[model samples]
Target: MRILQIHNFYKQAGGEDTVFEQEAQLLRAHGHTVEQLTFSNNDVTSTKAKLQAALGVVYNPQSAGIISQSIKRFKPDVVHVHNFFPLVSPGVFWVCRKYKVPVVMTLHNYRLLCPSAVLYYDGRVQLENVQQTFPIKPILQGVYRGSKIETASVVLATGVHKLLGTWREKVSKFIALTPGAADLFQNSSLRLRPEQLSIKPNFTADPGLGAATREAYFLYLGRLTEEKGIRTLLKAHSIKPFPLKIIGTGPLQALVEEYAAKNPLVEYLGFRPREEAMEQLKRARALIFPSEWLETFGMTAVEAFATGTPVIASNIGGGAYIVQHQQNGLHFSPADAQELASQVGLLEQLPDLAKKLGQHARQSYEQHYTPEANYARLLQIYGQAIGATEKPASATVAAEAGL
Candidate 1:
């Protein structure tokens, strides 16, 4: 199969970009001919360019034209879109429409429905925004940015796409990384075809880190952002009987270090390489996910699961999906220091129970979240998207024209 992968990457490299690259490698490694097209937000050079880039995020015909040309040149069997925000809008799917080629879009985040993909307000998860009730979102964003007009423009860009039904135009299937995300989309106005929607979780590089036996201390891996709730976790460390090891750095690094100074149990190890982080997950009692936002998916939680370490994540946001309560892992309220401390504290008291949960988490990984399992599901989805009755095309014939 000939596959053309398109992604408009944000300035900060993230889980979506990593997932895109991994899928590309998976396809190519499996002998499929894969072509890649990428547009980076980093391309904007000046204030004028940045302004134009921001405008383009709302809608960019230039991006559409470029994507159309790529489709013409590549003649792929189908177009697979990853991200298209702040540039290369949903217009790419429209471009695919022109050629009459099938399109398979993976919902990496809620960019299609929520303007601020994190659904945050005042530096916290605005739970009300999930089910927006009025024009107040725009009103708030305008005031939030210190200008009514500036925020309105950004809001309009995202709003226009939703109003125009751009999200549903000629798409063959939608790939969601989690079942919880699929449920949200199904309940939304921009819902995908039930039969066409598939759930495939993001995976990690298979260096076999999960095979190692785990130890005592808990681990918190990922960015130290306000959304990640690092401050709450650090405070939780103070009351903890068990030690909590912190990894990764972000804008909140200073706040983390300051708290660590007064708190003896909080060990700020700074940012470690991915391999080292995985090793730490393998050794930790449990990986902690204390996110304060509606995380699209907690890649770190899955990483912990892969290491046979049960996760103690906030029972909120996307973390709630991967860290099943009392089954594979335990959950605490987001940013609740007392709840977090209690949960972590429990692991020390019931070592046998923790071990059982960790083992269950590892089994969960093997049962549902492995590379081979994901690839098989993806193949089934791709086959269905192209209107192929069974697995393969059942014949090798060129299309009426190039993609």
Candidate 2:
């Protein structure tokens, strides 16, 4: 298969960018041709650039032209879009339709429905805003970067595409990172039909199994943001029996460092390279994933599973589905410090049980999150997109005439 992969990378690289690159590599490893049309947020600088960029967020004619030209030149079998936020915009979707191309969009975040894109606001999950046809509350409250103008730009862009039937008509299929995430779209005002959505989790490179003997400390391996329940994780240390190692930095870095200075049990390791993080994951008793928001998919949780380490995550959102309580791992109420601390105590009490859970986690990774399994599923999705029977001839004719 020849795939034209499109992605708009954030200023700071994230799991979504990692997944986009990884999937491209996975396709190539299996003898598929992949071409990329990439954009970067780093280019948006200065007052004039920021204003122009915000306008482009609504619709970028330049991006549409680029896609239209790329489709004619590359003649790809499928156009798989990972992210098209501020830079690429939804104009590319119209271009894809114009060229009679099957576009497969990956829902890496809730950008389609929520301006904030995290489905989060005011230190909590914003399911109420998700249910609304128009996300007025987010705009009013200045949800995106605490700027109403920024939030309005995203909201306007989303509203415009939605009215144009861009999602329902232009894109052939939508890939949700989890079943929970798929359900969100299905149940939302966007109203994607069951057949329109597909579920696919992010996969990690197999890091092999850890030693049988595990370390004493637990691991937290993601950005220490407020939505990640970093505050709750810090509070849990008040009753800590075992040590905790935090391996990332964000807005809560100073708070984590401050707590670590006072508490002997907490060790803030800052940001480490992938190899080092994986090494820590392999040796830890379990991964503490206390994210408060409805994450699309927690890649760090899967990374831990790949390292033969169990997860103790919040009993909410997509990550909850991955961590089966008392089976592969355990779950606690979201943002409940006491409950999280108690679960940690249970793991420390029963070494045999923790080890068994870790074993199960590794097995789960082998079964669901492996590259072999992902490659097969990915090809199936591409085939489905290519075989979409609803594409109209008018779209192709429009492109032929440069309409």
TM-score of 2: 0.95
Query: What does candidate 2's lDDT look like per residue over 206-225, in tens digits?
Result: 99998698988999999988
TM-score for each model: 0.88, 0.95
Pairs that clash in candidate 1: 75-403
Best by lDDT: 2
Q: Could you tell me how far off, in angstroms, the CA of residue 334 lies in candidate 2 after the best superposition?
A: 0.8
lDDT of 1 by residue, 1-403 (tens): 9888989887778888989999998888899999999999789779987777667766687888888888889898888899877677777777887787777888887755555566665667654544542235645566324566655555566566666666554577778777777776666656444555667677765545454455667888998887788878877876664677889888899998887777776788998888888888888888889998877788888778777788899988778888888888999998899999998888878887788888888788888778888788777677666873223232331121011
Model 1 misplacement above 4 A: 127-135, 142-151, 191-196, 209-213, 388-403
- Which candidate tops TM-score? 2
State the weakest 10-residue window (summed lDDT) of model 1: 394-403
- What C-alpha lDDT do the candidate models reach, one value each? 0.75, 0.86
